[model samples]
Target: MAEKASESSNSISLNTVDGKIFKVSPTIANQMQTIQSLIKAYDSSRVISLPHVNAFHLSKIIEYLEGKSATTVSAVKEFEAQFMKDLSLKQLKGLLIAVGYLKVNELLELMPKTVAKLIENKSVEFLRKFFGIVNDFTPSEEAKIREEIAWAFDGVDED
Candidate 1:
């Protein structure tokens, strides 16, 4: 009976897609809504498998959760800034997808805003290149679309 109680109270184990295991306190696990639901549905002692989350992304999410618990809001804000800045574009996209899947609310809010800021004031060509989107329209078709939506291009920054 005591062992059962202890097992229920133990830290949650998470297995990432890349096969790395992470142990997180209940407090941290509850912050991720997906993991929280999984914990509720299964025995807490069982390892929760995250098929969509890789080790790097999981580590970053855990780091964000642990780092943001600072005593001061300013310190947390600073930490969040540095965290976002440290990720490359590829890393940012992967982390954002993982955060979305895990339903990490704070990161879901922060990452999209960070992405918006990155592409803000940039031209369409720059955005296409930034996102690796291939332009499929021929020259005449492109010209027609541009003419129709000229207002959107009015204040676009040069590529």
Candidate 2:
């Protein structure tokens, strides 16, 4: 039937926020839950527009999907490590947002762990700087909180 033919199409087109279009196989598109839902709701033969995802992030997601496949488990671990390492802090944050928006389950699990590792054992000051969080507390308020939780700061890594 015509409906079955459309459903079994070779590739689906994705239109990014930056106006770039990417054609991806159903396997790849379905890996992104948001896109999978869109595919189910709309005609798979038409281009799916991602209003929140930019071209760079979309391309990175695609690259990650393709690279993770067709590799041994150990090789996939190495690939994931290298893939995360290659991204700058800005890119990592941006990609994490995109991954969250797309509901990519693998990345939803991986990225938060990676970010946690990045901040683990780091000082409050270092964390504030790393996340661009302003110190809103007055010096006295900060001193009071620190004094109250002095035990929490013991052996904390230096900034």
Q: Clashes in candidate 1: how many?
A: 0
After best superposition, candidate 1 residue 5: deviation in angstroms?
19
In candidate 2, which residue pairs clash? none
- Per-residue CA lDDT of model 1 for 31-67, tens digit only, reads 9999999999999989999998998999899888888
Every candidate's CA RMSD: 5.2, 5.4
- List the candidate 2 regions with Cα displacement exceeding 4 Å: 1-9, 125-144, 154-159
Candidate 2 per-residue lDDT over residues 56-128, each given as its tens digit: 8988888888888867888988898988999998898889889999999988887888899887889998878
Give the lDDT of residue 47 in candidate 2. 90
- TM-score quality measure for candidate 1: 0.80
lDDT of 2: 0.85
- Candidate 1 displacement at residue 34 in angstroms: 0.5
